[model samples]
Target: MTTDGPPARRLMRWRNAVWLAAAVLFLLNFVQRGIDLFSIILTAIVVALGFAVEHVETQTRRPFKNYLRVALASFALGLVLVAMPLLMGAGIWIGLILWAGLSGAALFWCTYYERTEPR
Candidate 1:
């Protein structure tokens, strides 16, 4: 069966906070260019942390392996994003699109294969 009530409510609150933080970071990146490297790194770390938080909040168990994989992916993506402007001489718009697409895919993977321990 499904769960309901306080626990679910708390989880929702945590999820909202994470999403808000991610959005704010993304917006900040859009408005500022001097800190592109820092922003990219911070965004990746934030996204990874958010995923870990969601996993813990939902499953009540820490999946270290999955977390490590996500962290590595985030870092690698961030590096690629940081290089896009220099490597391709592309504008921030293109970089943002790529970042968004990559981030969305990562989030989707997390949701699609959420951990569930055996009884």
Candidate 2:
């Protein structure tokens, strides 16, 4: 086997490892170069814009909500991506602020969204 774990559990282990690696890299990047509002906004904008590619790949007309979702995420993240760097210095602190903002927005959204709605 290419991996050490059992075949059934290998995928999960790799996924967890990838997550850990991402966390470490994020920390390191924050400590070194900084939050990089431009980079984060650019990354988020690019990701959101990628919905066009997703649409093409799926070859299905999605609902308006999908477009709205993409737009809102881009606008919001881009806003936070800019604000955090300005509010906090260009350091790990910006990362913390961004994380807090995102978490708060998520929880706020969750509180209003219908819990009964199927995932």
Candidate 3:
């Protein structure tokens, strides 16, 4: 079911905070270790997806906007992960492919939810 109100806003804030924390950790990992950490990248990807999926706006829900947001966030996160020195070349292609697939899936999900959701 769709959600809004204070609880959803709180959840959105919490998710964004988590994403920021994960992003900070990711940057620090690179700076300190001078190398890419797979785990940190994975954390970032998960955090980004989690934050995007919260869909916390109080106004009329817009699935297309959500799809765009998810797509951009996924691409940004995927770009960061694959651009690391450790995972280059094939990783670049893989990351882009994954981003496209994820965006498409998110669009499908958002459309489906919009139709099935109680209005």
TM-score list, all predictions: 0.37, 0.31, 0.42
Name the TM-score of candidate 3.
Answer: 0.42
Ranking by lDDT: 1, 3, 2
Top candidate on lDDT is 1
**lDDT tens digits by residue: candidate 2, 52-96:** 544443454434444445445645565567655655566556655
Per-candidate RMSD vs. true structure? 11.6, 13.7, 7.3
Lowest-scoring 10 consecutive residues by lDDT in candidate 2?
56-65
Tell me the tens digit of each residue's lDDT in model 3 across 6-32: 786777687678778877887787788
lDDT of 1 by residue, 31-97 (tens): 8765577667767766776676566546654455555556556666765675657556676666667
Clashing pairs in 3: none
Between prediction 1 and prediction 2, the one with superior TM-score is: 1
Best by TM-score: 3
Task: Give every collision pair in model 2.
Answer: none
Give the clash count for each candidate: 0, 0, 0
lDDT of 3: 0.65
